[model samples]
Target: MNRVLAFDLAPKKDYIEYINRGREERIGTMKVSDDYVRQCEKAKEIQGLWNPDVGDWIYSYGSRSIEKVFGEVTMRYTKVWLPVQEDLQAILRYETPLVMLQAFNDWLYTDSGYGCVNGARFHSMQELWLAFVMWERFSKVWDGKDWKVV
Candidate 1:
């Protein structure tokens, strides 16, 4: 299988467990944005991703795809995907300060942090779960067209 993200630091079992939490529990109480719904639609469109016809394949393919973009996959029993320490570092390193600030406000300070231990790094499970959430968000803007540049 193709490795998902460049920073594949999390374990595979973690991704499976997180995704197995099912959709509703993973999204929590946050208002599901139009963007979020759009993302789910994108995933459903992928050929082998989330095949509803096959009971065993619900989240596996989507999990693989998520790993490709986000490095790992994870899920939390919450409304939004909270950024982990690695994600915080990554956003700061690769994104603008304003974007980082927005991520913090949206993730760190919300109920997403309710059961999380506040520390320099989050529990590995937490980090993986966030990756899955990000994957869903990333799917929203993804067009099925080839990604390669001519």
Candidate 2:
């Protein structure tokens, strides 16, 4: 099985963004560009895919914001949403409770308190969730064998 790392699953070019309606509205009112409407529509389009709830993690192209009321405020960044550990556990349990419990038990008993799968060490809950997603989508697990991408 090929080794897969947690960072390998990170988005290279695109990222998710949080749309603060009040802030955006005020900013939009200050400007004449149609960026606000476009951003809202883009967010809507993305949200339409899974019908995500309030706390569900979703993907986006990226985002930017302006700060410093009196100076030139230009800041751009990628806002990747990392799921909280409890949220991830709930999601996994909802999908397959027994399997999740068994996996958790196995990991918990390991000498290393960290979670590692197929040589991928997960330092945080976010990394673990990303690994799970990658494995579910692109990996295949053979009985008594390491995971490999199919």
| Per-residue lDDT over 102-145 for candidate 1, one digit per residue giving the tens place of the 0 to 100 score | 66455544443222234233224433233333433332222232
TM-score of each: 0.21, 0.32
Writing each residue's lDDT as its tens digit, candidate 2 over 1-150 gives 322122232445322233443332222123211232233233322223332344433223343322112222223122222233454455443457778767655654554323443424433334444345434433432222233444
Indicate the residue-level lDDT of 62 in model 2: 41
Per-candidate local distance difference test? 0.32, 0.35
After best superposition, candidate 1 residue 75: deviation in angstroms? Answer: 25
- The positional error of residue 60 in candidate 1, measured at the CA in angstroms, is 14
**Candidate 1, run of 10 with poorest lDDT:** 50-59
Residue 26 of model 2: what lDDT?
24
Name model 1 segments beyond 4 Å from true: 1-95, 113-122, 125-150
Candidate 2 residue 93 C-alpha distance from true site, Å: 5.5
